[model samples]
Target chain A: MTTTLGRPGTRPSAARLGLYRAAIELKTFFRERDAVVFTFALPAVILALLGAIFDGVYPGSDVTSAEYLAPSMIAAGIASTTFVNLGTGIATDRDDGTLRRLRGAPMPPSAYVIGKILMALVVTVGETLLLLGIAVVAFDVRLPTDPARWFTFGWVFLLGTTACALAGIAASSLAGSARSAGAVMHLPYLVLAFVSGVFFTPVGALPGPLITLGSLFPLKWMAQGFRSVFLPDSILPQEVVPSWEHGRIALVLAAWCIGGMLLCLTTFRWHGRRGR
Target chain B: MTDTPAVRVRGLRKTYGDTLAVDGVDLDVAAGEVVALLGPNGAGKTSTIEILEGHRDRDAGEVRVLGHDPARAGLDWRTGIGIVTQDGADLTELTVREAVRHFARYYPEPRDPDDAIELVGLTGKADARVRTLSGGQRRRLDVAIGVVGRPRLLFLDEPTTGFDPQARRQFWALIRRLAADEGCTILLSTHYLEEAEALADRVAVIVDGRIVAAGTPATLGGRATARTLVRWADGRQETDDPAALVASLTRRYGGVVPGLTISRPSLEDVYLDLIGDPS
Candidate 1:
């Protein structure tokens, strides 16, 4: 047998490998019906339910309850798709030996991370569209006509999803097993949604400390940024600060993205907690 | 560099807190050779293999795989090694072909995914989802993924642990085909004495993190040179010269020794003795 020694420049480029990883990631993700329903449909269901329960428009604004909720739920949907989905999904991978198998292969770790984020991006987009459709058709919420609002929607979606996805990757390492990951990821997400005024109308109505606490995380700023895009400026006085803090929202989400990346780098484990 | 052993280790040691898992150990596997690490549970077989695979860090060791220290080896080195771990990846949603093809992309030069599936006798199951495969078929899929990269060295960590008798034999045949066709160096770990004897060119018996004996199946623990038992209908005797004892017994019977038998120790006996297991 001939030995082939030191074959240089033979590995597929990292970007190409990442795309392959993403392809597999998406394929497997969509096949799991439970995951699709839980990750993609749960937020939309919550929005529909909330839209039905809350009937009145805000005290001084023409924006109905459903219209106010439609945008914030989109933000929550992003968190669900990226943060909760990735946290549990990565934990499941670690638990089920997928990460171990990948680690054993010649594929770069960065490719695996990129694949997961890309899968989240695809799922988040689908989820956002579903929620928007439900909001507009079922609850009579209006789509944004202005190009500037759409532009705000794009950057907020991108930054918010990136930040939450990174946080999910970082948090995946905290779960001891796949069974516990749902709890570990959802507890913080639900709490943040409440304190961020995702379930409530008018962010100013939330307790001062709760709002302050929510501001420290990405979800609150993400919800606020989305509200700026969908809700009319007349509704701006209902905000805690009475103005759209677009710059602060971008800074916070961007910072979380960087911070979350660092956390993932420091904490990511390719194996289960007791694997070694 | 071509002459360097596919795997070489000296003074390999690892510990978990205060408990030493792998103590001072030395092993070598030449290219194209098949070596089995035979040990019972908790005997450091996994620790040593994982260390060699670069999946686990060693507390102290000088180890080289494919002519490079696994600890510092890059992707090039990784591409030359394939690992079939005990627990296969959960690719339940993917068809066997898809899983094999997915892994094939990781390597620069990979076997055709269909051919790899054929090599592992999984062509019929190629289109089936991984979750639908039987235990034996799932393990075969793991082998397909491992070999798709065309690795120069393959590490199989107890590949047939839970296989039935027929499945075990089939898996052994698959492994033998790989050794013959691919000429790849294989380092397998297993606790089954029969499995080690069947698949290994050389068997190394590990006990409590140390190699107690290492040799071919017939000669392990000096079994080849050990006293043989010569038995007849009336009596039995253990002697160094079994042939001479049998001749004497035949002559005493004046033609043939009734119910006569001559045998050396079986590999199981030698292994049991080597591991200090009375049972």
Candidate 2:
């Protein structure tokens, strides 16, 4: 056989392999109906449940509960796409030896991770749009008039989901099994959502440390970005309006993305240690 | 002919923390010559294969595959080799053709997907989902993917581990055809002694992270010309010249030697000895 490097043969390209990896991920994700229910349906269900329960009850004002719940529910939907879907998916692939199989292939390792992150972003954007559609048609929620806020909503959701998915990938490597991945992946979402005022009125209404601590994570800033678009300007204290300082949110998320990328590069196990 | 060997591994050493997985091993496979790496479990076969496949690194050694050091070889060098592992991914939802075509896109001069399927005797099952195929059929599909890109050098790591007896014979024929017809250099690692005898032009016996012996199956462990053991109803004898012994016995018996038989060590016997079985 000709051992020459540049013989007349088709060699593996990173771009083509990336497309194949992305297709495999989508097919696997959709083929499992239970995964579909949790990743796609569950987030929508949570959004609708929150919208229904809170559409009419506030302390003194006549604001509908759906108006209060919309932003936070959207934030929760983003959380599901990034953390819950990604963490469990990567862990299961590792368990099943799928990741190990890809290692020998010509597929670039970074492409595989980036493909999953892109899938998570697609799911989050789809879920957010679905929640907005429900808010407009079912609860008489007003659409934001400023197009710049819409741009902010799009950028925040994309960046925030990217950050969260990176965290999920990093967290998935921490667990030894898929079951543990699910457990660990869910804990961060629950704690961060509650503290970030994702399901509540505002962190200002909560304890001072709660708001300060919430600032440490990406969820609070993401939710704040969402609320900035829909909430009336008077409702937010001047200090909390999505200000130039909010750029720090992007910086924090970028740091997490870089940090998570490093952790996954270092510790991701493609196969079982036992070689089964 | 001063070009580097197709694969030259010299004193390759690797330790997993405290355990020495591959300890000071040396090997070479000339271009276009099929060499079988034969060993039992924990004999460092997998570690050696991983290092050669460029999936794992060695602690200290000089190693080369297709003229470039695998440890530092970049994307272009990696594309020249193909590896078929023991098991493939669960591609239950995709038809055989789709899966092959998807992998084909990764390579620059990939053989036609249909041709690859035909080469593996899976043309009839091209549209079938991989999960629907039987064990032997799926194994053939795995082989198809490995050669789809027409790799210069191929690595088959326990390629037929789960094949049934009939399937194994057929797979052997396919491997021989690939070597003779396509001129593809093959490195097949297997536990089956018969497989080594049937397909490999040369077999290397690796034991405890070292290559103990390497030669044609007949000559391995000097079995080709070793003393033959002859047993009769009344007596048994061992002789280096079995033909002369049989002739003398026939002359004394005036026609036929009762219970006449001549036996030499089988490949398995030689392999066991080479591997140094305590039992």
**Leading candidate by TM-score:** 1
Write the residue-wise lDDT of candidate 1 on B1-279 in tens digits.
558799889999999989999999899999899999999999999999998988888999899888888888788888999999998759999999999999999888899999999999999999999999989999999999999999989999999998999999999999999999889789999999999999999999999999999988878999999999888889989999888888877788898889988889888888888899878
DockQ of each: 0.55, 0.39
Task: Kindly report which residue stretches of model 1 are placed more than 4 angstroms away from their true locations once superposed.
Answer: A1-6
For each candidate in turn, the TM-score is 0.97, 0.89
Per-residue lDDT of A145-212 in model 2, one digit per residue for the tens? Answer: 89988887777776778777777777777667766777777777777777887666655575678777
Q: Tell me candidate 2's TM-score on chain B.
A: 0.93
Model 2, range B122-229, lDDT digits (tens) per residue? 999999988899988887887888788787788888777888899998888888988998888888898888888898888988888888888898898788888899
> For model 1, how does the per-residue alpha-carbon lDDT over A1-276 read when each residue is reduced to its tens digit?
233444548898888899998899999999998788888888999999999998888877898888888899999999999999999999999999898899888888889978998899899999999999998899887888999999999999999999999999999988998889989998998999899999887678898999899899999999999999888888987889988999999999999999998998899888786656
Candidate 2's error at B123, in angstroms? Answer: 3.1
For model 1 chain B, give the 10-residue run with minimal summed lDDT. Answer: B242-251
